[model samples]
Target: MMSPGSRPLIPGSFLKIMFNQAFPGRPGVYWFLQGRKVIYVGKAKNLSRRLKSYPRQAGFDPKTKLLLAAADHLRWQGLDSEIEAILTEARLIKLYQPHFNLILKDDKTPVYLTITKAVYPRILITRQTGTFGPFSSTRTLRQILERLRHIFPYCDQPAGSRPCFYYHLGLCPGACIGVISRETYAKNITDIQLFFQNKKKRLVASLKKEMLNFAKAQKYEPAQAVQKQLEALSYFWQARVMSLELPRLSQDQIQLELNQLFGFRVNRIETYDISNLSGTNPTGAMVVATHGRPDKAQYRLFNIRSLATPNDPAMMAEMISRRLKHSEWAKPDLIIVDGGRTQIKAVKKLIPADIMVVGLAKKPDRLVGVNKPLDLNTAAARLLIQLRDEAHRFGRRQHLRLRSKTLFI
Candidate 1:
């Protein structure tokens, strides 16, 4: 069984041995285990710092307090990046069905926007599968739904005997009033799906195409209406995309953007990642950036031994904690992890509140921070992306070396 953070401090020699033999403290997902069963699952930016905060008296949330008291041992995975951590934590929570996660077990469930399975289907808030989100901000998504409803009006209720109240408000186009044809309403539903899927570019392109078709058919007035709606969507979605928190443009640029975005001077940017063959041949890497360019001499690598099983969050957390323990290492102004929410949570605990933590999640790639997901259109985000890629490359190299050495035996 693992000790709680408030129990006692770690021994010096043990810390050294752990530093030598195990993975570096990096961002990751952790489990508060009661024997073999997981009672609760959580994530962090630094595994060491996060776990270290779990003292019996450490003022955690009520649910967390209960979870900590019941926890016997801990199991964790250090991850390659923050976004991966978020995805991994969610996946683990679903797979394990831990007792304490309110999101899973609660009756007053988180809301999801669902598209109905009907010819003239309804769009409604539901708890069903294949819906939009388990969003923290219901108001935000609801507002978006409301706004989108204006541009692409669809039925808010299933096929009804008479027109619903929303149709009069222009929130729905009165399919019940026979004012809209099936094919025309179907196109609006498709547009709604496209917007939710973050296919704004495709949706805009299609809208432009449709507008041109209208103009070509000498339907000038309809074409103008389509143009007006398309412009409105582009403007609104662009505002939502927002400017990204970036790095390595210039020393002055870094300071200015950091002050405006994350509220600090971001001179030194550090990125962490992990590589492994499933659970074996595990290696972790940290790459440093001074201003906008990489500082090659400051790069570090580790062959992970903390957990024999592959756990990306644990591996990353171990790496980051070890790094923070070293007083000699230069402190970073901003720390970038290669994954999303889980990765950010893992690292944020160890890092000072002033120092920003950012996660770059690939596959519909986004640069995410604590409560901030911004467009990755700027030069700084691109630079961070390169730095993360470099860390992964270096970590993979070390992993391959270790695997080959093992194979030779």
Candidate 2:
């Protein structure tokens, strides 16, 4: 994607190098800084993959593009899980008040309704277990529960002799007075869970039925209450979505798409390309794509070691052997070798038979493998082509860097 009237903060080889150094492939919060002052804060499940796509942002909002264009340095802190990343991001944004982080400005932690497994079932707003929603909302979240309480009255306070706060407010079904039975209370909690899960179709249908039943029985007041509940649900849903514009594809969603197209579950893809002029200053570059996204952090370069002759096959095999020796580096789902039958034959022996390998022929532009050749037009084919292209670019860059260094020395 191209952005009009703006440019990337760090483009080209410098951008690739910065992504590797600043955003290691992990769940983390990254800060975009310009001369020591932080400008943006973003959280990602895979920092390397996300950062690599910044310069190529297709539909980035104006504010986001501006942040990237203004930033001079990148900083990040790794987290354990997506959940942890979310929580940390919220905290970081609040602390820094970063100009680009428009969300989490309110001092409010996302309100979640927790239904504890108890005799009377205590429903409390918290960020603890059995809770639902870190759902982004400034005002509508509390209004939803308040309006919902009229139709499905449950308690958010401890049962006591005196009526609890919500009970007195006419928002609870007197859980403090033991008016709600366990079986019935569980059903109410289930409905709440359904609402939180965004199963609004069933919830809305059920609510509509109750509203109609009340209307028919001449229970006008209760029916009016139910009508209000429906309105609240619809309003809350609309408001929550309107809080943010349509989001970009998340890391999980990207992986899901890749998994679907690749004919198997693919989390990692590795591509290799060899660059040299008749075997002098030969180098093989490895580029990694995690979850269908390029991850510059794992990209590597190899100098030809064992091969003295100008044999591409031998050079590729040597690079593969060295890469495979580092068991700590995460393995790949598929490997793209930038050559045809001869290259595949040389390297296929080193790779396990179970692993998928493909060779791309420049002359025919055909994907060669054990299976039928695929045109470089399909999504999967396009992905392989992208990997191959990136590997070639990286290898050439590294080769030039080596050449420049030798000349200077």
**TM-score of each model, paired residue for residue:** 0.40, 0.38
lDDT of 1 at 232: 52
- C-alpha lDDT score of every prediction, in listed order: 0.67, 0.67
After superposition, which runs of candidate 1 have C-alpha atoms over 4 Å from their true positions?
1-251
Q: All predictions: root-mean-square deviation over Cα?
A: 25.5, 27.6
Best by TM-score: 1
Return model 1's CA RMSD, one decimal.
Answer: 25.5
For candidate 1, the 10 contiguous residues with the lowest summed lDDT are 1-10
Residue 182 local lDDT, model 1 = 83
Candidate 2 residue spans exceeding 4 A from truth? 1-262, 372-377
